[model samples]
Target: MKKIMIFGAASAIAQETAKLFARDGENLFLVDMNIGRLEAVRDDILSRFKTKIEIYEMNALDFDKHQELFDKAIQTLGGLDAVLIAHGTLPDQIKTQEAQEMIIREFNINCVSVISLASIAANYFEKKKEGCIAVISSVAGDRGRQSNYIYGAAKGGVTTFLQGLRNRMTHSGVSVVTIKPGMVDTPMTAHLPKSPLFAKPGVVGKGIYKAMLSGKAVAYLPGYWRLIMFIIKMIPEWIFKKMKL
Candidate 1:
């Protein structure tokens, strides 16, 4: 059975992804800061799939804890075949503008923590010469709109960081995938306006699973968002800046 570790497993997308993998008999190592939610997900997975599911309370922002967490996961599962990075913080943009600390926290949660985890995973995969790292970035990264530019900036860093890691790991047989979801319906966006292209957590989760299996380097969840973003990206800056997206 393939061993998979999901960081930020308390997330809606992560929970759905866990269900998919559990049904396939994959051993899952679920990490999150919320112990209660983590246990709930663990129980749900075990009940539905009769598979091994371990939950670990983890704070991604605590860089020192990463090695310990990784060691515990490997010890429990034996080894890792794939890792999903799904944790992120989306602070209100208006609040971020008022507080410098909020911006820093957002960056630390969304970008710095990801890099820390990726570094740890890279070392493991490089030695094994086999592994997959799938990260959940955002379509907001494609273009920094005024609506959520800080969030977009953080995700953009994640996108670029994964690209760099992919470049370095190619020869080591380690694959890195970036999942850019446009507008996902989750607790994070519960209050956001409705959009025709918005995707459900399960939908995005399935897309990530398929991408991992297919060795896709980068993907847009729901697929159509890929074309939409492509066109948006192609528009000249002068015109793009003139109109609200």
Candidate 2:
């Protein structure tokens, strides 16, 4: 059976993705900072599927803990076939402007932690010469809009970092996928204004599952956002600066 480790498994998208994988009878190692949320998901998965489900209470931002977490996962599951990076923090943009620490925290949670975790996964996969790493980035990374450019900037770093990792792993039998989800209706986006193109967590999870199976390099969740972001990315900088995105 394929064993998968999901970081930030308490997030809505992670929870939905866990359900999909559980239904397939895959062994899952669900990791999250909130023990309560992790236990709830563990119980839910146990109730629905007759498969192995391990829960890890972890803070993704702590790079020091990553090695220990990876060791424990490998010890419990034998080896990891795939890893899903879904943990992130969406800090208030206004607060970021006032506090450098807030901006740093956002970057650490959204970008640095991903890189740290990916490094561990890369080493593991490289040794085995086989594995998949799927990172959940955001459409916000495509361009820096006025409203949440700080968040967008961090996500942009993640997108670029994953792309580089993909390049590095191309010939090593390790597949790296970057998932750019646009307007996902999760707790993270609850306070944001509604969009016509908004997608549910389940929708994004299904897309990620398919992309992982297909070994897709990069995928935009909801699919249509691929074309939408393509057009947005094409807009000339002069016009882009004049209009609010």
lDDT, candidates in the order shown:
0.91, 0.91
Candidate 1 deviant stretches above 4 angstroms: none
User: Lowest-lDDT window of 10 residues in candidate 1?
Assistant: 190-199
TM-score of each: 0.97, 0.97
Q: Candidate 2: TM-score?
A: 0.97
Clashing pairs in 1: none
Compared with the true structure, what per-residue lDDT tens digits does model 1 show for residues 1-245? 89999999999998988899899999999999999999889988888897898888989889899999899999999999999999998878888978999999999999999989988999999999999999999999999887788999999999999999999998899999999998888999898887887789999999999998887999999898889889988999998888875
State the TM-score for model 1.
0.97
Backbone clash numbers for all candidates listed: 0, 0
